[model samples]
Target: MGEFELIRRYFAPMAKATKPALDGSGLLLGVGDDCAIQRVPANQDLVFSVDTLVEGVHFPLGYCPRFLGWRALAVAVSDLAAMGAQPVCFTLALTLPAADEAWLEGFAAGLAEAGQQFGIVLAGGDTTRGPLTLSLQVHGTVPQGQALRRDGAREGDLVCVSGQLGDAGAALEFLYDTAPATDAASLLQRYHCPQPRLELGIALRSMASAAIDISDGLHADLLHILRASGVGATIDLAALPLSPALRRIKGGAAAGFALQSGDDYELCVTVPEQRWAAASRELQQQLTVIGQVQQEPGLRLNADAGMVYSQRPGFDHFSIT
Candidate 1:
């Protein structure tokens, strides 16, 4: 099929599938337009983020198309969540070696499912022939002056993460055949389909002093907050949350995975000590306090043996071998 025909059949329906149900909507125009028109609600600011996923680098060569569709958009939406913004709409730019009908069908279904789940409409984008790659730009909104920022953390604030970590990293071992068999399904699900913590972010808008989505692993992502906020942190190795599947791995590998494994997509946030009670109550069982911000200017890990330093904290595109 032609490019326009492909879009009409596979992508156009996604635009309508996720149209906001609320009144006074911001999406004035979506797909099929040269440019999307959006209106920022009164007393709110628009938050924007873009993410790109390359075929071999981001996922396996023969990865599932549907999961790729969902993950591509979900990764970008996680950025909005870190800012404590509600997702509004998104644009997609897809590059493909060829337009295979079966692949497009699965991809469209997954993309639409994510849009419907997140209440985000497809805005406008482009498609071209090339190696398989997906780039998504997402738009969200937060009440003026209430958007959580990485630079807002302060000394004495408690650092917390939403949900468990290291599952996705452990899952990667199975995918790459680097580890013995365990529970592959649960781990793969965490790696393939990441659930952005949008609701939790919204709840913490008034409570969190600083926030960041842990796309690049806890150590690296937390350092971002520290640098941006001009502070340091002391994280307890024992406090890192690990999934049952991850913990089952032999030789106590879960700790290393939790600290350095990327693609967990959980939010790492800092809450003021005074607001910890309210924040923890709002988050309920989803929040885990793993550390505290400090007046010093470096990341310190409190381990059972003693204090430890991290040499490599996360994935670096250029540095990856």
Candidate 2:
């Protein structure tokens, strides 16, 4: 079959498998359109997020198909996690070089496994022949008025992060430069198997007014929230969390990696001081307060003199390649 034709038949149809059970009689529109339409459920705010992963850019070419699928969905869902929304459904669009049955099966299985873990369903998507890219649009639902945004952080709100950071970026370096060591395996897993903190997100729905998932380096990702809210942050270099595995491998560099490396897929949130204890208690499942939002409007790294540094500014799609 032709490339686009194959996509229309197989790839496009895959997206609709879950809609029958997810949407009521009002699906509005599915695939094969310029845009999709759906009725926003009563008492719910529709949350929208998109993420894209390239084959070589995001994952190594030898990366496992199942892990790739898992990571792809997790990356998109991470955005929802940052928004403090409950994942509802998602659509995938994949562009591949060829139709390899084994690869497709493994990829689909991995995506399904992630869906099961997160209580989300595949709604719809599209596929086409190209270099190789996977883009997912994840839809989440929150209380009618409580979907967290990146613009609501108030001065004095605490900056919090879910999970340790930099392991993923460190993994990338390990893949190319270092021999297979104990830390290499763990770091690679961090890059391939991202866990989106959906539970913590739902719990912080009302407490955190601003949030964003760490995709780019922490410095760059936090700048997103800071820019949106017209605020700044003072991230305690000492408080940044580092996985024990990473610390063993990179030592003091782990903190810098945690701050500047991306692909953590962890949620960074800002909660008011009054709600800190309650929010922290609830999100103890997967969160930590890393810093504080500042009245000043610029990014600052609080640390001893001249010790702070970032290896790379952040992941920049346009500039990287």
Candidate 3:
């Protein structure tokens, strides 16, 4: 199919599928237009983020198209979750080496599924011929003056993370290693289809002193909050949450995954000591207090033996060998 035909057949339908959610809403015009028009609701501010995933750099060259479609959008929307914003809509710019009909079908299906799952609509986008790449821009809405930020953390705030960590990291390690292992399905799922913690973020809008999604490793992403808020943190290594699947691995390996692995799309939040009870009650079993914010201006790790220092923070795009 030609470029226009490819878009009309696959992408246009995905945009139209969101019509029910956008009808008479903020989305004035969606796909098939020169520009998508949207109206921000009163007393609300719009949040925007863009992310790109390139084959061989972000994922394996022969990765599953469906999972790639879901992950490409999920990572971008995780930024909105960090700000405690409800998803509005998104635009996808897709570059493909070739318009393989089967691949496009699976990709469109996955993209549409994600939109439905997240309650976001595909508004508009562009398609071009190139080495495989996917770029997505997502928009979300949050109440004025209530958006969560990394800079809002303060000393004495309780550090918390939603859900388990290290599963995705473990999955990556297993994929790259020659180790023989059964029952990798769960870990692979975690790596491929990350669930963005949008609901938890919304719930913490008033409760969290600061918040960030763990797109990078906890060590690196937490430092972002510390640097922005001009504070420090003390992480209890023993307290880091690990999934049962990850726990099946060696403890030291799991800890390394939790500390240095990226792409776990979970939220790390800071709650005031006094507010911890309330936040804990609100989040129920999903929240785990892993540490505390400190007045000092660097990260410290509390281990069983003694305090340790982090040698590397996270995956640096420029520093990757």
Candidate 4:
């Protein structure tokens, strides 16, 4: 099939099927155009971010296209979630080795599924022949001056994280293994599909002083916030939220996975000392306070102030290979 024809046959339908905005908002025009039109509300600020996934580097060759489609967009949209933005629409740029109808159909299905779940419509995109890669740009909006940022952390603020960590990192070990480990399904699910904590992000707009999605594990991602905010932190090693599945799979090294492994996709937030109680009451147990921002210049564990962290801090695409 030709390029335009392929788009019409697979992708165009996605925009048409997307859940329309309630009260007629956001995307003014989508797909089937030279440029997709968006109408950002006057009172809200526009937020957008791009993420790209190369086949071999990001996922295994011949990975499930359906899972890849969902993960790629979810990963990108996590940026909007971190900013506490309301998702609007997304544009996908897909490069494939060949126009495989089966793969395209599966991918489109998964992308459509994620789009509907996130309340994001398909704007427009490009498809081309290449060594399979997927790039997504997601757009969102937030109330003026209400968008969450990573540079607002204050000394004595409680550092919190949404949901459990380390499951996805533990799952990485079983990705290609024919023999599945204990509780592999639970761990693998975390890796293959991560739900962006959009609702939690919105909730944090008022409650959190600083926020970031935990894409690069708690250690690395939280450091970004500290560096941005000119602060330091003291994390309680016992407080890291390692899932039971991760504990079962990783044995004694579960804490390392929780701290050093990547792709958790949870939100790391800093709540002020005074409002931590209110934030706790609102978010309940799903949000865990594992640390506290301090005036010191570096991160340290509560147990050991001067000990080394890990052999490798976290996932660094360039540094790993």
Per-model CA lDDT versus the true structure = 0.86, 0.79, 0.86, 0.86
State residue 182's C-alpha deviation in candidate 4, in Å.
Answer: 5.7
| Candidate 2, superposed: residue stretches over 4 Å from native | 1-39, 176-179, 305-308
Clashes of each: 0, 1, 0, 0
Worst 10 residues of 2 by lDDT: 18-27
Model 3: residues with Cα > 4 Å off, grouped in runs: 19-24, 176-183, 306-310
- Candidates ranked by lDDT, best first? 4, 1, 3, 2
lDDT by residue for model 2 over 1-321, one digit each (tens)?
A: 665565564445444544533536224566667776665666788888888888887788867899988999898888888877877778888888888778887888788788778766666677777888998989887878788888999899988888898899888777664457787888988887899988888888878878888888789888889999999989888788889998888776778768888888888888898887665544654667778998899789877554446646666779966
lDDT of 3: 0.86
Candidate 1 accuracy as lDDT: 0.86
- Candidate 4, number of clashes: 0
- Model 1: per-residue lDDT, tens digit, 54-123? 9889988988889988888888999999999999999999999999999998888888888888878898
State the displacement of the C-alpha of residue 304, model 2, in Å, after optimal TM-score superposition.
3.5
Model 4, stretches more than 4 Å misplaced?
18-24, 177-182, 280-282, 303-311
Query: All predictions: root-mean-square deviation over Cα?
Result: 2.3, 3.2, 2.3, 2.2
Supply the TM-score for candidate 4. Answer: 0.94
Which pairs of residues clash in candidate 3, taking residues 3 or more apart in a chain or in different chains? none
